[model samples]
Target: MSSAQNLAEKPKYKRVVLKLSGEVLRCSETGDPISWDTLRKICNQVKEIHQLGVQVCIVIGGGNIFRGLSGSTDQGVDRTTGDYMGMLSTVINGLAFMECLEKMGVQTRVQTSIPMNQVAEPFILRRAIRHLEKNRVVIFVAGTGNPYFSTDTTAALRASEIEAEVIMKATKVDGIYDKDPMKFDDAVRYDKLSYIDALQQRLNILDSTAFSLCMDNEVPILVFSLNDSDSIKRAIVGEDVGTLVS
Candidate 1:
């Protein structure tokens, strides 16, 4: 067997929390609603990881459906109200993802911070752990069920609560860059960075609150692009595919 196959057989982490931005679910190429193709692609990636015997939990953002910060200005809504709307958006994404995973033959569950019994289970820590132990992928929705808190923070909080080995942050960019990679020609990417360096230097890998919580809890983070095929598997297998922020 190859080294990658050997590492995959070992299984390093008992559990991990993946943070996916809602924008990733949307059809960015077509400028329409959620794309079935995009959803299927992500589902396949998750399915591949699930087959590896790694317990996976996901926290999805609502930026694709509704960005609170932008909604407040564009729609003339209050900040708190817009944020609440954004939280609901995450629930929608979670449900869609759950359906996709189920279709792929991967048993999955959706746990919402906000009580939505009709759609999913309530956010219970023990129940979540039990699901992981049973080899079910749990998708966490509703973004902490409160305003003024980003989903990035939710990822950290859930990781710490569930004792996740690492936080895999899925972003459009491949990794943390010194400058906006799209806007600058010479943006630098760090292979690995200390938690303090990410905070002090403001690397933009994650929100301040999320970074602080991860640092305090000693939870390492892996920032990578979800669009990259096999990237999730690479991350779980300890391959050098993205920026490692610990």
Candidate 2:
């Protein structure tokens, strides 16, 4: 069936920011940082969401390639310098992801916090919004271009700047669990939670700084696993697929 036909189901939000884990680029337990097969699958999912007529923005993590905070402790790299390296990793990830998306015939634009004009346009709020208006997927990368800031916080910041309806965090786990689902088979999954409840309960799905930004802005977030091929489509199509935090 055509993607348009498949996503004929209603979309809950008109505009959203999809937060991708760096693992999305990892092929497997032992594979290249960017696995073509996995990337193609992810591109296909994003295409379906675009076809649904909902505006799409994305913030992808860089843990698959490098992590700034880890380098400080493990490699004894200067914390500031390591964070900058980590930011660069995100740009590379964006480039690789863009290549796959273009191959799928999707129109996209990569906007970086730390502008490398030759590679991608600088992060321009109005320009990014215009791209979304034109149905072009905009990828916001480079993790706020600052040390000590995480991609999770970047997602929240970008979502607020773009006035996105919600932040859709794509995780490997199905949804927020009372405990680590993998470690405890009896862990309970939360279907719905208020922002205050999430904070009070100390849910680890979103970092405190990032979570606070969403709470302050009144942006709802949906956390769902990306393991299934149709999870993106299902979540945006208003299906009960993940934990909803409002």
Candidate 3:
């Protein structure tokens, strides 16, 4: 059977939550501001899924602009304060993504966990649902408006709240591996795994809090490489292109 046929045969999830790290927005070589090339690539992928009539919601991270917690120890800033700064960074990313999606002629809305009336609407579950119903891609930012919560956790929370069928985690790595695939050439890539196995092995796939949330809520997560052309489309269409962690 063809790959696309295999993908079409898998069970289809009605709606999904996608989590994107901020670093993916930046240039891989320079690690600078949002790369237009990368943004366009992602936009194309999202557009493909949008065309597929899938209800999509996105949670973007802020490591590219500023990873506050990572720098807190060196800068002597409180962890909470640093985390808030990280949240703000996500807003910036949301705006950037909104602009790109708009340029692509795709309707999008940026909603933040924290209120920013002038910039974006505060996250309201009902309103977000409305947007999705209207075929508008919703971009959720600000990481739950709380310190210490990563975007991954936010993804899980939002997915559960919205009753999404699955959460799609876009990462640098193609799938979840037994070890750091980049460092360990012999690492094994898993096609499917239980949340318990990931936790027991300490796979470093999703953050502990995020993993716990998914486990408790029974929300399946698919980890895949964002750089792969048409990955988001393939994922939304039920393709087995990544590690499925349930």
Candidate 4:
């Protein structure tokens, strides 16, 4: 069979947790945070996946607007305060995603680990499941509602809670490589990596806590480039489009 035919195979995942870094919303040329064009591109792709009958849950980071560790810390903000600020950034980002998805006519909800009654619903396991059951995309926000926990860990925790089949980690890079792909031209990308190898090699594709949660829960992770249009859809369809870490 042809490669295109192979790519057209039926989807294998019924439900998934999509982890998107806030950097995905940035404009490369102008370096403006929260580019509407970028946001729309991602939302459109998400709508496509939603139409395929997959229960979509998104976990977005705040690195683009504010990171707890960097920028804030370097500017005299203490770690705890900086992290809280970062969490707020994620809420803002989650609202942005909810707006974009709703505008596309995709049913959506923003559930925050940190409760903000006026802005979003609290993260309740049963409620989140019901939202998915009703075909509404759930956007998890606020980074576990705790300081020191990365958004990556939040994605893992929520995926486990939501009973998602897999965690689809979207990044700018095509996939996980042995070395920094941008700096090292000879860096090799792996098609599949065992959890043990990933840990032992210190792949750093995901935070250790997040990786551990997935390892303990036996939840597979697909690391792929968001630059590839329809990449999330392709991952759900079981295409060999990214590095699979399991």
- Kindly list the per-residue Cα lDDT of model 4 for residues 1-246, writing each as its tens digit: 797865575568999999999988877888987999989999998998888788999999998899999955589888889999889999999999999999999989999888789999999999999999999999999999999999999999999888799999998898899999999999999999999999989999789899999999999999999988788888888878889998
Q: Rank the candidates by lDDT, best first.
A: 4, 2, 1, 3
lDDT of 3 by residue, 110-137 (tens): 9998999999999999999999999999
Where is the poorest 10-residue window by lDDT in model 1?
5-14
Residue-level error in angstroms, candidate 4, position 204: 0.3
Off by over 4 Å in 4: 1-9
Cα deviation in Å at residue 185, candidate 3? Answer: 1.9
Please list the C-alpha lDDT of all candidates, in the order they appear: 0.89, 0.90, 0.89, 0.91
Whole-structure CA lDDT of model 3? 0.89
C-alpha TM-score for every candidate: 0.95, 0.95, 0.93, 0.95
Candidate 2 overall Cα lDDT vs. reference?
A: 0.90
lDDT of 2 by residue, 164-192 (tens): 99999999898999889999999999999
Clashes of each: 0, 0, 0, 0
Best by lDDT: 4
Q: What alpha-carbon RMSD in Å does predicted model 3 have with respect to the real structure?
A: 2.6
The collision pairs in model 4 are none
